[model samples]
Target: MSLFCHRIEVKSVQTAGIIIEYNPMHDGHLYLLEQVRAQLGADTAFVGVMSGNFVQRGDFALLRKHARARAAVESGVDLVLELPLPWAVASAERFARGGVEILSATGVVTHLAFGSECGDAAALERLAEALHCEAFPALLRRELERGDSFPAARQRALAQLTSPKDAALLSDPNNILGVEYCKALLQKKSAIRPLTVRRAGTPYHGTDLVGAQPSATLLRTLLRSGERDRALALMPPVVRRVYEAEEAAGRAPVFRENAERAMLARLRSMTEADFARLDEGREGLYRRLYETSRSACSIEALLDETKTRRYARTRLSRMVLWAYLGLEPAAFPRQVPYLRVLAANGRGRELLGRMRKCAGLPILTKPADVRELPPVAGELFRQEVRATDLYTLAYPDLFAAAGGTEWREGPVILP
Candidate 1:
């Protein structure tokens, strides 16, 4: 259960891992897989470490992780590993670190591929190096002291130290996360090389369905508005099938608005001390949250009330969700505890077998396996269980909403 351990030698076949949320599997994701596979050759296994019911954007996924994992495997991924709740909902730095740690622990991956607005891997690595320098901290601190947001401060610091082209890359969301992935790889000193595919089709935050590959945000909008056919067209055939099946069973679309009441109630019951324990909860922000929760009728209202120039709405939303889920900053393990398999095809199963021998961390294939974890790891696992229970509460079907789906559901096996 040591947090930082020596990296073990990889023993399995060549594999590539992608870090993703896949709120709903879309063609853009498939394109990345295709590009990676084409570059690496079809023999190379593709593993995806995906966010669970919750995501980094500080919200519940449009569909559950299992469903999304299944779609991923059906479309192209050889395997899908669950990125635990704590890290999945964390900021980009932690999210990237957690994912890189898990993928590295698997002892099979040779490359870490990610979508980047700036497709140059070497350039991103240089940016990562600059950001990791000892001098960057003092420069960043000065920018923060000037009241700039964390992202803005980091960007300003980078601009002062690096080329304008490199600094501008941070402004794009995909590039920001891509830089973090590289940073995490450097932090771990992992042997896994980083690869980036230029983002195509729609921008990350675009709202319109442009051509065949619409943004996940646009697809979510379409699904929420009952425009199923339109959304389906933006995804691959296999992914479309999964979405259609989930919707038919009354469990496809789960939005933030569905949890508004539960979120507000959870916030109202907590004191400033309780809020103080959440990530990014500090500097009287907990007091602001406590006050806002008392009068704000909805999650949106509470967000609007508490959000400042320094804090983005997405950060506020994540904080509220963390408070609702009773997640404390200390609850996260210093190192990722395990790689929980969400879905796997035959080739994936082979990779798992090789991983069992060399993986530095435990590889969990079922819910029962969580019980064998150390106290710290088990505590983190329980957070995921609670997250599943809370997430199911948003399902359209009452039976599904009764909870405990995490225990009953196993890794999705695709033929």
Candidate 2:
């Protein structure tokens, strides 16, 4: 089809990169990779990314990162990098920063690619520019009081605050993330040119399969039901063994019903002063958090009870994660210095071996090497381990392999 075959050839990939969670490899992603390669050229190296135990949309990856990475390689990507938990758990801005930082750190990556509703590189950049302006935030607050979702409020705020040329974003979560990608690229002032492609056939939040590809949301629903046979059917053939092995060993992915209880308990146990240290819990957010926790039984309950015009659900999600990690509210890390490798394909494995010759940061393969990270990063990593331990509680099957057991150095790979 002309639509999926559209290609942008990269004459030479100074470096072409993508930040992603191939939660399950699907046709939409197959199209995305085709676009990335066409623009960057056939010779252009494809860099894949796989999210860890905790994922961006607030859950576990149905198949582990390594399995997912190998699947990307089989599908046509040349390399796969891990979006480490420290980054995988944070807010969009933080997630974007860590992602962009790692990609830019590759020293050769010249362009960053993403999917968007608008699909115009020039327009997204302008929105990013306005977002950084002085008047945007003030106007943003005014529109937010209309009780639109935080995304809608930001878009309307941008509409009134900026020129007529700037079309306000219409509350799309994928497009919103695309905006964050632009924001991070600009923030770092990196040389990586930003590119965007229009998403096709289905909306990101759609739950049905648009064609050969189903939304990650739909795939998650199947996995959540413990229907591996159904979910695995959509995945690349290479990932089947991994899932089957996990199933046989009674080690599989499952989302916990009460993963946030400890975080809620942390919030409940803390004084108002304690909540102030989290990233979004500043500016009296802790006050709301404390008040909400009094009547709520869960994190979603707290959000439902207290979310208002000024606070967004995304902010609340980050706040819960931040509190669980015991993050100092005031300080979020500026960059991810350690570009650790949680998983890789054969091509990616080669890249890791060669990166030491030209890279700026350490490329790690195991958790032990990450021990020297700064206080927040180290603590955050530890929280991820605890989160992993906590995550395993949801699946009785996983205990046979890595239960409440501590995480070890090597990756848990399926042969």
Candidate 3:
């Protein structure tokens, strides 16, 4: 089996891999899917590794992962797999690495596709190369010592090492992640080729719905604010129906505020030593978190107290979320051990048949299949199970919240 081959053989299957959160599966996501299919050919299999209940923005997803996966397949994606909790809530580099690893392990993806503000694959690759140079770390450390945040310090370091033009690419969020994806591919020495599509319409952090394409951020705001019709209008018809069904079942529009008290209780109960273990930066952030948790009454208040010029609010949010979920940095795996299916269409089923022999990792279509894998895989699955149980506590209908749902539920298969 050629585990990470980038080259496409004559008249062979061509697969395109994408990393997505699809928090609500809006028009912008649909546009990317359409563009990739048009560029890669209609028959090219598109596999998306989606974030489960938690998203990279350091918050709960607007909807459940399986519901979003169903919307993804209905909208156009061939297959959807879980990105796993550790990677889903991690920093940009690890998030990109985990997504890339899952795609490469499939042994089928030829191109890793993503949307970028720069939309220039060569420029992103060059930026990735600049960050990997030996002298870059010293330069970055120098900038950090000046009390600049990580994002700012890294950009300055790149400007000094590369050209200002190359460093400016990091100004855009998509470009930053695109560069990380390329860096991950380079680090793994994998054969997967990086591909970028120019991101169009509203800015990534845009807060209001506008024009033909709106950011997921805007839609999420609308959903949480009870502007359901406006938010659903931005989504595909099938996706709208899916979200509607979830709403009817009292499972839609999950927010951090729903479980705010629980989160604060968990954080307040932790010791300074516990916070130290969960801190990834080793920048004495745990001390700030420990101090802040005592007086801070709400999650927002805790984040407000802990926020600093050097530490972004998003980073602090992840730390708080991990503490709430009992996730220690040590528990996060160095490598992804298996792929868990979320949803799939007929074409995805065909791809799975081929993956059985070629895949680099074990595939889990049913939760119980985890028993056949190594102990590490089982441990990860157990974490996922516990995560699902905790996630249910945030449901709009308390009666609908139930444990052991992860074990009884299987992947959503569409004929």
The best candidate in terms of lDDT: 3
Show model 1 residue runs off by greater than 4 Å: 1-13, 279-281
Which has the better TM-score: candidate 1, or candidate 2?
Answer: 1
Q: Would you estimate the TM-scores of all the predictions?
A: 0.94, 0.82, 0.96
Residues 135-206, model 2: lDDT tens digits:
988888787667666676777777765554454554667667877888887777776788788887557777
Model 2 CA deviation exceeding 4 Å by range: 1-14, 141-149, 161-166, 225-229, 239-241, 258-273, 279-283, 295-302, 371-383, 401-415
Q: lDDT of candidate 1 vs native?
A: 0.85
lDDT of 3 by residue, 65-154 (tens): 999999999888888999999999999999999999999999888889999998898889888888888899999999989988899999
Report the error of model 2 at residue 303, Å.
3.8
Highest-scoring model, TM-score: 3
Q: How much is the lDDT of residue 9 in candidate 3?
A: 61
Residues 186-249, model 1: lDDT tens digits: 8888888888999998899988766667888888888789887877877778888887788788
lDDT of 3 at 167: 95
**CA-lDDT, candidates in order:** 0.85, 0.66, 0.88
- Candidate 3 regions exceeding 4 Å error are 1-13
C-alpha RMSD in Å of predicted model 3 compared with the true structure: 2.5
